[model samples]
Target: MPGTYPVPPGGGRGAGPATVPGDLLAELDRLLAPSVRSLRHSCAVDLTFGGSLAPGSRDAITIRHLDGHLGHTLRDLHVRAGYGLGGKVFSMGRPLVVRDYFNTAHIVHAYDRAVAPERIETVFAVPIRAGETVVGLLYLAQRDDVAIGDRIVARAVEHTRRIERDLAVGVEVRRRTAAYDEAATRDHRAVADARRDLDEAISLVGDPQARRRLREVSQRLHRITAGDDSAPQPAADGVLSARELDVLQLVATGAANGDIAAELGLRPNTVKAYLRSIARKLGATNRTHAVSLARESGLLP
Candidate 1:
């Protein structure tokens, strides 16, 4: 029900062309071709990815790539939720098939103009979901009334799962990149603020002892604000191993121990050992303090 709605054509927020990359389209084309062959379908197959067209409107799935068929009607066609065969799949977030598209009373023939010209009688659609959200649909079709068997459906589902895994990974990579960028910006601001405060303190102080303490603090902050080349290197003493550094870097990115283990191909226990070693080397009482010391000591960037 959430992904089912129909509004005027090209009237939604994403009315323009979707920002799908060429490499992803190419990969989808490659995967679709093999899937059609493996399913032993004599007709054409294509992939349509769903994206938001406007706020509060259901996402429309558009034909991005096809392995077969010459009709321009099917190409670039936007399928809305609860409208046609693909729409039903999009709304339900699962696989659906109509042996006879025109004759089927189960789904509305909203896109008969496109389907009739293509002469596609049977259609099978599977939803490609990333996490809990359905992101796209994969379709296998035939020009004749052929019953889609269980084996073919199963194989198509498997391919959709593989595609979903790739999409999920891409999403995670983008999220982490954004997080790192925000963190870097915050670190720069913190360094500038520290320098400004130090300058103000030195100017305002009249006592000789207090002035010396301010200078010491200024020197410490300078070491942190300066580039790694000017700062004292931590690796020279071999205090923290390369593996421990790897764990700390991910930890600074807000990764849990389990995620660090998965990323570094280590056990959870091994990740804990690395963290303990890093904390001991930095003389930090906790993980947060350890990360602070690492950044200050030029062990992390």
Candidate 2:
């Protein structure tokens, strides 16, 4: 049975101002409001979001948002692990409900001070997970002691799952943005180093012809490094399929037909057929000539 646990003064309530971006929080409110409304119409009257803002802390889930009449009482409430109905759901990583909150032996009554004011008798709590980690808790409550049916529980789970997906996508977008910024910094440094090396080489070279050739190569490298540079367009006469391009890229690396077949999960005969078609498209007589044509056409780096 769940039992009441002590909450530190001014601790078991919503933390200070939100750390999440305002836009993200607004978007979350927009996306989640409909689900809460739907749940209210179909199952329960009150719905609250206890977001896991501080994963490292014992009292991680804070009641951040509410969507019903009981909002005034439940707002800013914090639920720690293994305490209260929401905490039990968070700690257990599952959904739970009680027909009568005060009488139920499955959950602690530590939250009665807040819940009693709201007159919430029946309540359901579901854990919202981003991948394997529980990131939030969703609660559905009502003023009566009516039992929450299985369909309502399933609906609550489904709604929470959608929130989990959005949270995961936000996390992935942040990770990719950071990675791209790091890569751009590295590229800038590499371009600077290459320019310095070219200047040094030009100074050391005595031959006029060699210096001119180096200058030409440097100009080409600069063009390649420009952000506006686009991939070479294929010939107007023929367009290669994606699979053919895959095979051609492998051929550009000097891979044999058998090696290409193994890498592409195709038979050697299929590899030969692709090569023949590529040769025809490029007007090349053999595989070696076909590779040369592809390089000249800027089809492969």
TM-score: which candidate is best?
2
Off by over 4 Å in 1: 1-56, 203-301
Candidate 1: TM-score?
0.53
- Deviation of model 1 at 297, angstroms: 25
Q: Which residue pairs come into collision in candidate 1?
A: 13-53, 13-54
* Reference-based TM-score of each model: 0.53, 0.56
- Deviation in angstroms for 294 in model 2? 36
- Candidate lDDT values, in order: 0.62, 0.64
| Residue-wise C-alpha lDDT for candidate 1, range 114-230, written one tens digit per residue | 878777777777766544454456777767676756666667677667766766566666668879989977997798698888767676766544544454455556666655325
**Model 1 residue-pair collision total:** 2
**What 10-residue stretch in candidate 1 is worst by lDDT?**
1-10
Tell me how many clashing residue pairs each candidate has: 2, 1
lDDT of 1: 0.62
Where does candidate 2 stray beyond 4 Å?
Answer: 1-44, 53-55, 103-105, 173-177, 207-301
